[model samples]
Target: MKNLLAKKDGELLVSRIYQSESTQFEVKSCLIGGEQVMVIAGPCAVESEELLKETAFKVRAAGAAMLRGGAFKPRTSPYSFQGLGEKGLKLLARVGEDMNMPVISEIMDSEDIGLLADYADILQVGARNMQNFALLRKLGQLNKPVVLKRGMSASIEEWLLAAEYILAGGNSQVILCERGVRSSEPWTRNTLDLSAVALVKELSHLPVMVDPSHATGVRSLVSPMARAAIAAGADALMVEVHPQPEKALSDGDQSLTPRGFSTMMRELEPVARALGRRLR
Candidate 1:
């Protein structure tokens, strides 16, 4: 793979100049950036304690290495569900602990860092907050790992530099996520940008994961893109898996039901094997 670093961009801390070797670190017993691709799956938002537990159990049983749920959602409309807030975080942590799985949740405000850090094993910097320097700096100060998602309109170079903010803050445990970028096409929610998966793998040593659920925003396409992501050199995948998606509170159309996620996992196994990697 070619390491395509722009002439003027190599000075950033996230650039490959500082670290040529891949970043492999243990997060809740799973080695990210390693040969074993990890699968992090769960509902888009934590609806209820009972529902969260059911979905968490299902995704874990289907081979998800980590549990993901949104406690504080950044919705386009104020009238929509904003998430369960601290209640959701509590449920995610409670269920994850009971199941012995790591939990991941998004952090919107810098003030919520301690609150989220107390529950979420990994603090996710959503696409909207990709360039939130204040929040990024706060995450940098913490020892926790942060999953920095690419902004909907941010360039790959800009995205890497955003990760640089966290790295420069003295926290090296940062994971990059490509959750699709804004595009004019109407069929898909956003372009998945599979090339970025390969590019980031070469441009930086940090592990890159793709969010097919948000990328395609369609249940039928999530599985297909997930397999393609692994083939394109993605280190892991973040999928939205819900129980009875039709009745879900958020992103029901794009969320995969438990059965669909199971079938997707079955399809992903061979593709991962083809690359000499196993989904953890």
Candidate 2:
């Protein structure tokens, strides 16, 4: 009788067993879309008419290439704030039309695809849903671009496979996002995996971005990490900004004030220039 199994004691292996050739994929540059990097910035969620419009205008004026905000938030606690639902999506869509910038927001379920597709120019599949194969399959069927994040507890290979799910589904316009991952240390909300930023560019044909805001879960850390992400070869940056972080309805602690965001953009400009990339 053959012993069918040996004890494997470590991380759960969810990665597809294939080493992608470096040339097999290439990041589709947003520069081709009229910018060197695609800056997706907005509030954590769209709370109201005034707040949403205010943040949208400010970020656009500050040179963001794209806009983002969560209309359907996926919080840890059921009692915690969820989102504005389809109404929020409509607000984001209206902002896109009014401001002339592409809108990006999270899609929590497969069922919301049609409703959300009508609103968002780019659909964001958050870190929590990175490996939600069913959701990935649905997003892949859409025609819009996807901003896929690395799972909170997923490995590098697992992350890429998630991206592969979208690519394999016949949608090639995918963007990779490294938004940190859970670690034993609690100094920061999650350990920022800057190495994954480098590795993704090395391994795949997708444009990679980083979210320093969620990575640290603190306003102070956003700038430094954002600068580091650019130097580490990130194709774009996704930041959360609010006019008044202290009063924001969600994620205020991690939200950068408009003043802070302007400063971060200034510092990031030089790094982008050094990398032969332009800033809008």
Candidate 3:
């Protein structure tokens, strides 16, 4: 109990203890942790320049402020498609510039920090690497913003402590993302833990975002859970949008079509407005 309480105190993040406001920062023109519930949408991976450009354009039209696509993918299987690497980062940077939007992408190691920071506007520390203190500290020293996703098996205190690793390194522009938690139920990919969204609001001053696409791992559930996230007070959302889900290189089942994403954006507006926030 004592150790748990000490963890919750988040010694390294005391400056961000939840009061009545959240820490805000700007990525290009998008104000993260601000009034609007920012949305980041794009392919799960940089399959190709054409596919990436198409998805970026569509999502931007649907009201997304920032774009996202993985360059260094951390796959569970050894034989699975390991992302396009640095080449993918170049394409992501090019498309993000052409689309006139800020972009976010994952960082798997401290060595690749310089490479990813060169292209991505917001460097994302994926769920699997949540406890990677070494990488987290490297990210903290960067001037760029970082989106830290919650580890599937980690507790809330553990998640905050991971962010502390970055905060302790001196980067205050950290956004916590809930991508769901591992569960026994096989019906859904992972339980979306909406409670965490509300809880983080009270436990920390940092803004919280949700990745419904990964949380449910089903296209149909993405939009509904996205709405729930907004109602639950998510400051932003990271959704995967592939032009054609059926042909996606990765996470196709959970990716939304361009048209489907447009429809989902339309449906999310009222929910955000009801909470006195706008769906960016």
Candidate 4:
């Protein structure tokens, strides 16, 4: 009883010091069966079924445990290429099942949850919708797991509080994603705060992942930042991969080539192993 109390007290201390969410979540294992760290890789947006399938096949072949695609994209420009919506989601669902992997796609609006949940194994909340409390609460009420990305400008407390909104709503299968934050620097699209990766692991009971592709907004920097994220204690990574990045309609600059992804996967093995984790 004394030891239990002490341990609980220790946890409380850590939470206060680091703004943690209680580090005790059961991270879902790879669907294909492995002790390796989970990797979700695919294109940033679903342009076409053929393109999506091609990228999914290559990434899965390179040992990606899950496939990612943005079915309902939240583009900055109204004139920019919007996603294919329900049709695109159907494609992702089909590809995931046919390819023998789990599917993940972003959720934007509250009304689309039921339809999106029907197809997605994991519902991803993009950084732009991090504080969409209504959506978060709705997700919390669902049975499927949610991958919540930190907002671009939200502080650590606000980020966790957003997660808390979900947790408090009753859903506990939440995965925290550090996808970088808005910063004054113009070199990188966003400043990938890897320190938050380590901090999340230390503070929350939820599995913490990183999105280096969105963080850097450049393909060349994906591998290095991915490695760093793992070193900082990320349980998973959400990377963008495309067969022909230059031809991609959205986020082409940040999507890795098949060869580049394969190389990064090879390099990630050692980092995961060194940290007492394995890479699938």
List per-prediction Cα lDDT, in the order shown.
0.91, 0.80, 0.89, 0.83
Can you tell me which runs of candidate 2 are displaced by over 4 Å?
1-35
Q: Tens-digit lDDT track for model 4 on 202-242?
A: 56556788999999998899999999988887878999998
Candidate 2 lDDT by residue in tens digits, 1-280: 2211111552211221232322112223234122366677899999887898888888888888677888999999888779999999988889877888788899998998998888887888998899899999887788878888999999877787787778668787777889999999778889999988887665665678899999999899999999899888887899999999999878999999888888989888998899888765
Clashing pairs in 4: 20-203, 21-203, 22-203, 22-204, 22-205, 23-204, 23-205, 24-205, 25-205
Model 3 poorest ten-residue lDDT run = 1-10
TM-scores, each model vs. reference: 0.96, 0.88, 0.95, 0.89
Q: What is the lDDT of residue 120 in candidate 2?
A: 84
Sum up the clashes in candidate 1: 0
State the weakest 10-residue window (summed lDDT) of model 2. 10-19
1-280: candidate 1 lDDT, tens digit per residue: 4343444745556767668788878888988888899999999999998888898889888899899999999999999999999999999999999988999999999999999999999999999999999999988899999999999999898899899889889999999999999999999898999999898887888999899999999899999999999999999899998888888889999999989999999999999999899998
Superior candidate under lDDT, 2 versus 3? 3
Clashing pairs in 3: none
Sort order, TM-score high to low: 1, 3, 4, 2
List ranges where model 1 is wrong by over 4 Å: 1-10
Model 2 error, position 242 (Å):
0.5
